[model samples]
Target: MTVPVVYSACEAYPTVRFVIATQPVASSLFVNPPQNLTVVGVDVKQRYKGTHGIWRLMGDLRREYAIDAFIDLHDVIRTHIMGVYCRMHGIPMSRIDKGRSEKRELTRETGKNLHPLISTRQRYFDAFKRMGFDFGETFTSVYPTGADTTLFADITKPKSGGERWIAIAPFAKHEGKIYPPGLMSLVVDTLSQRAGTRLFLFGGGGYERDILEEWACEHPHNVTSLAGKRYGFAKELALLSHCDVMLSMDSANMHLASLVELPVVSVWGATHPYCGFTGWHQNPANEVQTDLPCRPCSVFGNKPCQRGDYACLRGIDYHAIVQRLDNVINQR
Candidate 1:
């Protein structure tokens, strides 16, 4: 007797492609490959410009790629619009519900009403499930491809004398989530006291990079800035993988470090781990965030602290982080 086989679109359709409509930050987190995924980075400016243009682009994507199924990793207004287009075109669509976990925690923490049950990664996976893919079976690590690896060759250069180094990703896309330069300086200084360890800073060149560079100059022997170093995401990963550990803000670096399997000392400010975006792919060796009542004011951090004081981050003692790093370095 012959056995019957069932095939979903993802399986039946050998040419499975993914259209990732998300911001750069979110796309950096959601975009994965070897499953034949194609990411269409939603240009923030273009999407914000006009509703019709955004819809038109969605239509174009639908017609152009003949996209089998659409996954809105970002379930915001823009993605909603695109999802509608996909549906109108008779294409199945899925969106990850990112708010469920946060909603649960918020109700418990603030004594507020339960919002909803959703999670960022879960919502993303839901899109696949809609097309007959099991979330558990399909779940895979987000990895950099050959192109990505090629991009980071320069920055991932081996250190002289085969010395081990610690990477510091101090700059966050949002200023509110960034630790103050003075506080970071203290952390770097404390870490520098440990011999045989080198410090390399990672970030794009900007005012924050300038500030970090100034701090690095103060401790020239132990610290150096690799912020402006021309490396792509893949190269950054390579450099991150080479590090003994990473000290980073609660930003994309946390996710990236997880992908590289580096031990991360994540410093939190306006954000908290309960948001579910914390170090999903990396080992979080230490999480340094003040237990402030006003912590996690928003799901995504804002420009300034909502309560003016920014106690969530400002209250975090620099000494605590130093002690954690000391323990990590001094461990037998």
Candidate 2:
């Protein structure tokens, strides 16, 4: 999500060097970045372990790059600690305004303010603007021509002109955001029956891999599972760039597909797009969600359903999702 904003910043200020520090796992997403942008992976778990490690990281950044200013996209305790280091050094800094109060009211159990809020992407852009930088939206597909996927020959074959490729990322970090497995399987079965349509399942973790593999086995001819393949972000994004459309929850995969300018048919439950996490330039017509007063109970979909039934997700018709995907893919 932040990837696009950073890309725009780099493009807007070509003469200024922009170094992006992010998690090691996410560094690969910065494929074909602008020459002015340098992405560095910080291994917070291993190299930057705790408070002391964060302090060391600050020292290293100043010593190595002579950073002119610090911007905190993620305003957690770790980032705050880094801010402290910048303050001590008399370096200018800014942090993203997350609109926590607005988010809380939007997700309150009752009397929810359901209007759309500033998007996370916009927040990132605003953070840069506060630091006296200006830019318009300058991001497009990460793969301008097409991604080179020659290394993935075993899992993927050459794309045929008649084939319609669809990528499905069925898992989310939270149960509230996930569709029911049985119903999702129904959707899979229905789509598998379509002519000239191939499905690729994307996910991670042992349990998710098992489920994806099972679906692939069930639809042996049309479906392929890429879960647990350990392809990493760069290769996965390459594969996704070739896909006509992606079906995913409001998870990292949705954002990943968006980075490649692939349209996503996103499903929402406990999380609402009004909370401003929608994929960049995705059509709202493709969002499959149920309308309920108790909706958007959590910002990240991490909270358990207060109604205990999760009617927001359960009430959604699987056929609606299938219809939306067909509309997007066939129109393309």
Candidate 3:
């Protein structure tokens, strides 16, 4: 008989259906797939707010799906509540220890010489194996569907209109994660001097959007700030998809650009790709980051650098990045 499993997290559930749970967890679980699955999403924010209600929802879902097993990709207190509820109902469940992964990354960032461990992608698979699912391959996958595409308009903008374009994503969830604005401007100015090249900014509305506008005003005709403009993630993806290349700090846009298969020049500050959250869908050969002693200051880049200098990002050689960009764009 086919095993009945319910997979749930906050996002990305359609792809990973087996033993699914609600949002965040759902989203993380959807990154991997297993046979005989039913996916569910619990739309909880990253921060804890509606956690008390999660158990009630999970209880309802369990009865509805006759959920045999619960796979908690999100191991928060809320998930713990669900685990307790599942036990009360005599339903077997397993949880992926994301906190341990975070701790491992933190240890590595703090100059601790931990033995080289499995990739983040592999760790997810290993989590499943603990619950009796055996899978191989450690790389994360991103498959954009029609629903994801519907976020953008169908019109293709011309890239050859006497302008060499470089896409810039300046905003990330954390402030320290961004490359310093002065440095960003310097890179844009240096690159704009190349014939037919211009800078196209991509991001949502906020303080960073204001910064992009200020940069655009300073550069006038060369820099176009589209940060707060009318464009969905799909449109942004489509636009970045056509650009010769992209320059981004560590953020969701980095992942989005990767999905479009864009050659990205990533700036690493508080976080590092070795933590396993690097380009999920892009070519590994194209990622550019600094190898600093104080690099990878955090797992999610939520904290400021302990040292005031932020040398990991501030110390990056602009010339080297430009050279790498030349190689990537020329080959494309």
Per-residue alpha-carbon lDDT of candidate 2 for residues 57-104, written as tens digits (9 for 90 to 100): 888888888899999999999999999999999999999999999999
Stretches of model 2 off by over 4 angstroms after superposition:
none
Model 1 local distance difference test score: 0.64
Which residue pairs come into collision in candidate 1?
96-123, 96-124, 97-123, 98-119, 98-120, 100-117, 100-118, 152-235, 258-281, 258-282
Q: Evaluated with TM-score, which candidate comes out highest?
A: 2
What candidate 1 gets wrong by more than 4 Å, as runs, is 1-15, 21-32, 41-49, 100-119, 137-153, 160-162, 283-285, 303-307, 326-332
Each candidate structure's TM-score, on Cα atoms with residue i matched to residue i, is: 0.78, 0.98, 0.73
* Alpha-carbon shift of residue 112 in model 1 (angstroms): 5.1
Residues 76-99 of candidate 3 have per-residue lDDT tens digits of 778788888889988887776555
Ranking by TM-score: 2, 1, 3
**10 residues in a row with least lDDT, candidate 3:** 1-10
Clashes of 3: 24
TM-score for candidate 3, residues paired by index: 0.73
Candidate 2 structure, TM-score to reference: 0.98
Over 4 Å off, model 3? 1-51, 99-111, 114-117, 131-165, 196-198, 218-222, 281-285
